[model samples]
Target: MKRHITGLFVLSALLTIMACKKSVEVLTPSGSDETYKVPQGNNDYDNTIVDYYNKYGTYMLYKFTEKDVYWTPTGWKKPTLPNGTWTTGAEVEASDSAYINAQLNLIKNKWFGFYTDKFLKKFLPAKIMLCKKVDSVFTNYVFTPTFTAVKGTKKVAAFYNYDNIQVNYGDATVNSMTAAEQRLFIYKVNLIFMQSIYARGLNAPTAEFANSADYNTAMTTYAQAYGKGIIIGYSNITAQSDWNAFITAMVTYSAPQLNASVAITDQTAAGILNTTKDPSGQIKRRYNMVRNYFINEYGVDLQLVGNATRGL
Candidate 1:
């Protein structure tokens, strides 16, 4: 997917996928006089994943959607400042927790199916609480105040503030989801995990491009074939765009699976893109950066991830 196919697919799926993602049962906030609703069943997941989560992190249930995290003893402890006010950065929810557990289970299962490496398995964030909302105050913080920046940042025997990958369960929930729903959910999780955190590390691993001439030439060739609009800001933000190109390519296995989002006017250039043709090998150069980063950094064969992700 040296092209923008995954980006396009992800964008396309967002507005519609949430509509079908199921609904959540809101619980009464703590201290409310109203009778408390019964908490949902915790989705039992893979034992290895459950053990990793229980031993390393806490699953929290909050009071509302998009509210500040106020954790209870059953969950992780909510961080308190000197003033006794809670840390204000995290978007969260509960049945939501069950749904989240299911989502995490899906991801865990996919990881086992695809990746032998434990990098993501060991570090993936599990929502510590299941609640209605989390206050949004930590926009300025490096992490959203869900978990620590790294797994061991707060490293006390299972008592550190680990970072969280916020899964806002306000709009929908997944419990015993259908195969299709699970497939789509896993796809989105993989995409977000890849773009937001996973790929960011790969951004600066290699040196910046040696020269802009080769880049410019490639852009010109690309513009001529795909139209100037496609590469309009190509030169202005090559690195960021390069990462996107890498993600797209790394996610999709081939042109056949890329759907029709990619509009290639020049059939020859399209062939070159698919590696059926390459006048100077310029098109593949950008893609190689992403592929090489994975191989060199984690010693991972990214093709395995692509194959597994694509299988879903």
Candidate 2:
């Protein structure tokens, strides 16, 4: 009886050791991770927020064409002033609609259709917003293998935490309201999409890809655009409050109104003659308020980027 009992104890100890070894193996690094391609099935990568945006984000961006032309009075008019110059609302709407439709078609037929699979089905029905401008917009499409969504919401808050790396045209400026506003518009839209990804119970991908020096550089470059690039009208970002305010205003108010065809000429001319706030400059405050908040709340060490020139 005593011998049998001892053998049983030994067997239990060995089993426990084997189980622990298996657990350790499971937790070990997946051997110098690489961008593992999906075999077009139910892979986790296929369902990631990044992939969803890659396939559908552009389509969401293109939808703004409808909202864009409508937002500007002259946008819906036809163009007779010049071939490129917008003249009438009808023509403007038609022209823009054509381009937008084509963009939508590409997303639906080329991007999303190409990648449909079981994984995607689990996370369909997402909201997407398009920023008409901003260089880092491409980040919407880049794939990241690992990410965690907010605990309870489908909004991807990870972007708020990711290092504010900037990318192409590092710290550059734009020439016109139409151009500058377009970027602001795009930024707002992207945030909406981020929210959608979060709502789906998926977190935006984390900076885990930072393990790769190349990807790290890419992320840094992508972030720099927002931190250093021309901020359309605002001058600097000093705190998190600034970022929140800017994002709120951009998403809720500014984005829907800034479009290509509006001839603020009437207002612009009035400003030139009266020496008043460049009507554009008046709206500039909404932007300034955001930058100020960033400086105060976020602690961006670098000087803020602004319109007209690179002012603090």
In TM-score terms, which candidate is top? 1
Task: Provide the TM-score for each candidate, comma-separated.
Answer: 0.47, 0.23
Candidate 1 RMSD to the correct structure = 22.9
Per-residue accuracy of model 1 over 12-121 as CA lDDT, tens digit each: 89966765554323544467632222232344533433465455453433333322233433454354343434453333333243355554555457433444454444
Candidate 2, superposed: residue stretches over 4 Å from native: 1-4, 16-20, 23-181, 184-190, 193-247, 250-312
C-alpha RMSD (angstroms) for model 2 = 20.7
120-228: candidate 2 lDDT, tens digit per residue: 3433343322222222211112235645221121111112111111111101122122544434423433343334334444432223211211212232221232233
